[model samples]
Every structure is written in C-alpha cells, then in structure tokens.
Target: MENNMNGQTAIVTGAAGGIGSAVVTKFIESGVNVVAVDLYQQALDVLIEEVGTSGGEIVPLAGDVTDPLLAIRAVELSRSKFGGLDILVNNAGMGSDMVPLWEIDLETWRRDIEVNLTSQFMMLKAVIPGMIEQGYGRIVNTASAAGMEGHALSSPYAAAKGGVIAMTKAVGKELATKGVLVNAIAPALIGSGMLDQPWFDEKTKKQLLERIPMGRVGEPTEVAEMITFLASPSLSFSTGAVFDLSGGRATY
Candidate 1:
C-alpha cells in the first residue's frame, strides 16, 4: 500500500488477465512503471484505457509469452522506457480440459507445459541478466494450488505448476547471494474468468470451493497486494519460498 517505488520499473506477463492487471495497477500505484504483456491486442488496449496509471505508467505489449522474442522485447522496453527493470512477474497461464491424465493427447499435454511452465523459464532467462548486473531484482512466479496437491483431472496443469515451484526454489538459491530474490505464490480457486472455462462445471466448481475453509474464492487484489510486497525492496531475507493465497485451503 505504501508508495515506496518511485523510479522502479517492471514487466508483468498476462497483464490483461484478472490477477495480472491487478498486479500492474498495484505497482503503478506504488510509483513503479510497468510493461504489461499479453497475447490479445484488444485486451491489452482495453486494459490500457481502463487502468490508466495514477502515478507511474503501464506500457502494454501484445505478444505471446512463449515467443523468445517477446521476452527480449519486454526487457528492452523496460530499459528504454524506465531506464532499467526491477521486477518480473510470470503470471500468464491456462488450464486444459477436465480429462484424466491417461486420456489426454500428447500435444495438449505439451502445450500446457509450454504455456504454464516453459514460458516462465524463458522470461526468467531473458530478465535475470539485467537483475544480476544491477545486483537488485525481484521475481514472482504465479503457481497454483493444484500443483502442490495434484488436482484431479488436471494433471498437466498440476505438473506444470509444480515444476514452476521447483524452478523458483532452484533459481532463488542460485541467486540468493546475488541480490535478486525469486519466489512463487500458490493460489486456489481464485474468483476470475478462469472459473468460467468449460473445464469447470458447476459440480467441479462446487467441489473446489468446498476445499477452502474461508468458504469463498480469493480476490485478485489480494494476490496483487502480496505480489507488490514481494517485488518491493522491503522484502528482505526471504527467497526460494512459496506464499499461500488459497483462503485457508492450503494444507501445507
């Protein structure tokens, strides 16, 4: 909530999505410039128009996070626009159909991994150098509760998110002494468009809501607030960790 970020800059993937847009807005409120990246041009445009920054600014870039060039372009925009990059939020992801692991096709399985996991790796690979050179950076990976508990009928999505958590730990330790902190957040049943997907029938949604002791889904703004702190200079001495945002649903 405190506006400590005066001249900081960041790149946020899935910036047009519910949680992603909220994260961008929070950063901008805290006086941090943000380069918002998403695949849909219309969505990016609509977001840019709606969420006009009050203090800092948002630079919307329409591109796929899976593309290697998109990562490079985002990094360059951060440097050129805001002088340097300070934070990177890998928040872009989607779920596949509600099918058993054995029943899913190979291509769908691979696509799930690419969008949910490999894309995060690619972004981190492109952004870490600038952070290393500066000796100060914050990286937040958006993981899912399914990854931790291995949700039924969403094996590919679960597997990819699990990989994200592990990768965050490995990279966080690798840069622990380098002044760049990396962490992940595992959220369950967020109240977003994700719940409207065809994979989530009324029964499926009800079953998921029952898991949260709070009896409700998490708000995107709540996740954004946590992300703002982790991406700020105030977050010291914590890295390679997983933050829980499951409304009391996280067992671990």
Candidate 2:
C-alpha cells in the first residue's frame, strides 16, 4: 500500500458525519494522524472507538465548527497532538432549510453562510500560516453541486457553497507560489445522513433524486476517495479547481 501520508497530520471538521467520517477513515488508512472535530461528543466517541480498533491515531475534539474559537482550538489541538498539521479538510457544513426563497428568514440564511462558508474561511485562516512556514499544505474545501448549479428550495446553501468555491480559487492563487495547494470538491446527492434531517421531506427527496442522471445517490466512501486523492501529496499542480461528483447531473 502506498503511504502518502505516513507522517502527516490532517484535521477533518464534521468528522462525526457520514462524509466527514469517511474522509477521516481514508486519511488514517493512508497513515495520517487525524484530528477529528465535530459538535457531537457521542458521535465523536463512536468514531474514536472505530478508528482505535483499526490501530489508527485519531484525536477527537467536540465543538461547533461555526464557532470562531473552535477553528483556532482545532489548529492548536492538531499541533499539540501531532506536532504539526499538513492537511485541513473543511467538511463541516449544513444544508439549508427546504423552504422557498421568500419564506427563508434572514437569520437562517446567515446561519447557513456561517456554517457552510465562514467556518471554512476561518479554518483556512488558522491553518495557512503553519503550512506557509513549512512550505507544504493541502486544503480541501467541500463545495456542492447545488453551488455550481442552483437547487430549488436550497438557495442559501447554494449561495454559501458558491462562495466557498470562489474563495477556494482566490486563496489557491494567493498561495500558489507558496507550495500550499487549495482545492474544492463539489458533490451532489451523496447518501449521507444529512438527508435524514427533518428538512428533507418526502417531496423534497423525490425532487432531489429526480435531478440526478444516475437515478441514485452516491456513497460517502466514494466521495472520500476523491478527497483523499486531492489531499494527498500526489496533487502537486491543480489548485483553485473544482472536482465534480454529481453523477452526471452537472450540465456544466
């Protein structure tokens, strides 16, 4: 097995969720020390137990990713536990309320942006300096196909993810000469637990499924595979780009 991350440290936010947990597992499988941050302590405990059984080193930190202080704490925790950080996976995000645009409240919109966009920016701000000093880093921001192409009843989420995509490109270029690569992954209709939320009613779920050309949702592990590749040292060139996982639903 190729150990691309034999001595590296990676921080994965939302590590308790399906997609985030998959990414954490992949990183650990690749020999990377992992700092898994999430808001749920119970879920984190389960993740820790599972990773431990595999002889993997994973430090779980329970906190809300949208909290500005949590990002700083995560970076500090990674440095303290693993000695340093090499990769940051901004996977902490939430879907918007399945309400129409007119029915969406300002607070809900703001919260969506805060969770899906601002949190990533804060994480990047906290991690980039260390990467710059070391002259090596891989930052993978999770965007969405809804961001690339708008989804009905998900305007705020789409907007936030769209901002994430744009921010990734701008930051990638800013650090292009510094050997710190930044990229965004746009996934659509992945069979993650996020779909189990109350916002996803039967009608909404049907609407979502109909949009996918493959007529099925993707697996979290499949998405994790792509993320692992992007976060690995093998990705040398290719920053400020978006990789699609939309099941051919992406017209662009």
Candidate 3:
C-alpha cells in the first residue's frame, strides 16, 4: 500500500527501544525523515547506526522525555533539519513496578505520571502550533490496554496510560477540522524494553498472555506497521480514535 509519507518529517520519542526503533525503521522505509528521541545517548547512537542505512534520513536526540524542553527541542530539530514537522509519535514511556497501589511510593507514582502522560502533553504543546500553522499534521500517541481495563498491581501505569487516551481524544477533536489528525494506539504485552523490566517475571508474563485470546505476545514490528498507517495520509477522516493491539484481548 502507498503510505504517502515520502519526504515528510517526524519526531518519534522512545526511539531507541524495541517498539520505537521498529516505528522508526518503518517510517524510514516509507520515505520519512525522522527526529528520534530517547534517554540514553549510547542507545540513540546505536539506533542511528542501525536505521541510518534503512532509507530515509534520521537524526538522534538523547534526553529525558519528562523534561518539557526536550519536546521543544525535538520539534525545533525536525524543522531545522528536515524543513517541517509532519508527524509526532508520542511513544516514550515506562512501566511501573508491579506492586499494589498502596505499596507504591509517592515519587514512583509521580515519575510514572511524568514519563508516560506529561511527556506526551509536552510534545503536543510544542508541536501543535507548528502543525496548526501549516494546517497539516499526524499524531499517534502510545497508550496501553492497562489504561482501558485497569491492571492490578500497576495502578500508576494504568492511570497514566488512561490519561494518554483521554488526552488524545480531546486533542483529536480540537484539530479535526485543521487537517491534522490525532489518534492513539493501545497495545498490550508487546515485546519491548518495557516488558523486559525486572518486574515482568515469568508469572506476570504468563498471566498477561493468557488474557489474550490469541494466546501470544505482540511483536514490535506489528505495532510499527499500525503506527505507520496512522501517521500517513491514507488514514484521512479518522481522529481521536484508539487502535487496539491486544491480540484479540480488547473487547471494546
């Protein structure tokens, strides 16, 4: 299928991780230049080296997503390097420790909210003005099934992802007539760094997998494909919608 994404520029947060890198690679293959953002310089360097040979241009930025300035810088970098920003992938996020809500520390809860929810807000704040001025844009925020159907022992992550879903809906409606489409993806148990954390032990993984009627975990590449579609002109007429990647687990 023709993605109609050639020569466009995008900023993808969490660009060094499994799902993020997959999205980056998919974007490049579709002829899109990218401004990739992540927390570790070394990981970003490795990502650039790997995807640099793909097809489209890619520049890497290492910074904390929680820092609002990083969002501004990323938007600026996309314009300065690639002429204009056409897409924004709010993908940078982390999972919280597997613990009861009462057992979670206040700082941990705040961190979870900061990384998963506030960071997306910052990116939207920075990128929306340019997109509005140009009268065109595509935004794909990464949400989670945990948000839709709250997860036990993971309240903070659930709450933050839920916020992402709500925010995407609100923004999508606000830009529906401006030729800028905003949507979100709610993925469950994707094979990524977020799952590789120490908290996701065998028992947790097994339990999550069993919840899926498909009886398996999702691949990062699968997620990349869906995200690429959402970020393309081919997806016209859809905004504030949430696509599911839950291996048949999402009933809504």
Candidate 4:
C-alpha cells in the first residue's frame, strides 16, 4: 500500500508501550515525523533510542495522557518541530482492575474512563482545529473489543472503550465533509503491557486465548500495520468505522 505519508507529522499517545512503540516505528518507517507522548521520560527515551532517527524525525514529550494540558503541549511540539500535524493516534490507554463492576471502586472506574475515553477527547479537542484549518487529517483511535462486546469483569474498561467508539463515529460525521477522517480500531487481545499486569494470570490468559479462533495472541506489529494504514492517505472514504484486530474473536 502506498501510504503517500512521507513528510507528514503525527502525534501518537502511549508512544512507549507495546502497541504505541510499534506504531511509532511503523510511522517513522513511513517517513512521518512524530511527537511521541508517554508518561515517563525514561521509557520514551528508550523507545527513541531503539527506533532511532533512520526513517523520520521523532521527539518525545513525556506527560500524563489524561492531562488536557499535555495535549496542548504535544500539539505545540508537533507543529514547531514538524511544521504542522497531519495524523493522530489516540492509543494511550490502560486495563482496569480484574474485579466485577460491583467490586470495582469509584476511583478506579473514574480513572479508567478518564484515561481511556476522556483523554482521546482531549486530544481531539486540541488537534482538530488545526486539522480542520488545513482541511486534511487522519485520526485513528485505539478502542477494544471489550467495548463492542462486554467483558465479564471489566465494566469500566468496556464502558470507556464503548464511549470511544461512539465518540469516533460522532466526530467522523462532524468532520466528514471537512477532509478530516476519524476512525477507531478494536482489538480483543494483543501482547502488551496490559497483559503483563498481575491480574492477567495464566487462567485469564487461557480463557482470553480460547475466545480467539486464531488460538494465539496478536503481536504489536500487527496492530501497528493496521493503525498505520488508517493514519495514511490510503484509508480514504472510511470514517468513524472500527477496524477489528480481534483474531476472529469479534463476531460483529
């Protein structure tokens, strides 16, 4: 696929995680300048050092993705460093506790919503204006199959990702005629930091894998490939859609 994305600029949240780093590397290889965002400076530094500067420019801006101000700073950094922004990957998210909805605390529920859903909204709020002014932009949000099909014990996560799917559709319609395309990806299970959590014990992993017909977890690079497509000019005419990376787990 000819992305035709050379020299374009993007802001990728969760730039240091498994999926995030893979997306950053893929974008860089596609010749897209990136303003990588993550919470810890050290992690971002490690990712930058690993990906290197061989394909396109990459600069890190460490901050909490839940912070609205971080979104503004990231936008400023992208514009100043790469001239203007052309893409956004709202991939910064986390897994909630393995407890059922009734067992989950209010703080945990609120945090999950804030980090997964509201943070994406904050980024859209910060970056959409410039994209609208330019009349061209690509946005690929990271949702989850949990949003599409409810998870047994992860209500907050499911709720937040469901909100992302809804928000993506709304924004896509709002910007459809303005040359800005907004879409989302829903993946059931991909090897990432989320799986490394203590709650994801062997039994849980086994159950999750059993749901996938592929019989194996997806790699981060695979997710990156699809996200890169969505962020490229190659993905015109599809907005507010959710691309599945579910390993056959998603029936709809």
Q: Which candidate is the best by lDDT?
A: 4
Model 1 misplaced regions, further than 4 Å: none
Ranked by lDDT, top first = 4, 3, 1, 2
lDDT of 1 by residue, 1-252 (tens): 563777799999999899998888888778889999999999988888888858789888999888889999999999998899999999999998999989999999999999999999999999999899999999999999988999989999999999999999999999999999999999998887798888789999899999899999999999999999999888989999999999998887
Error of 2 at 105 (Å): 1.3
**Cα lDDT of model 4 by residue, 191-225, tens digit:** 98989998788999999999999999999999999
What digit string (tens of lDDT, one per residue) describes model 2 on residues 1-252? 353777799999999899999998888777888999999999999988776645348998999888889989999999999899999999999985687899999999999999999999999999999999999999999999989988888999999999999999999999999999999999988899998998888887788789888999999999999998899888998999999998888887
- Per-candidate Cα lDDT values, in order, are 0.92, 0.91, 0.94, 0.94
Point out where model 3 deviates above 4 Å: none
Please report how far candidate 3 places residue 143 from its true position, in Å.
Answer: 0.2
Which segments of model 2 are wrong by more than 4 Å?
A: 1-3, 53-55
TM-score of each: 0.98, 0.96, 0.98, 0.99
Provide the lowest-lDDT 10-residue window in model 1: 1-10
Kindly report which residue pairs in candidate 2 clash with one another.
Answer: none
Supply the TM-score for candidate 4.
0.99
32-150: candidate 3 lDDT, tens digit per residue: 99999999999988988888666789999999999879998998899899899999999999986799998999999999999999999999999999999999999999999998999
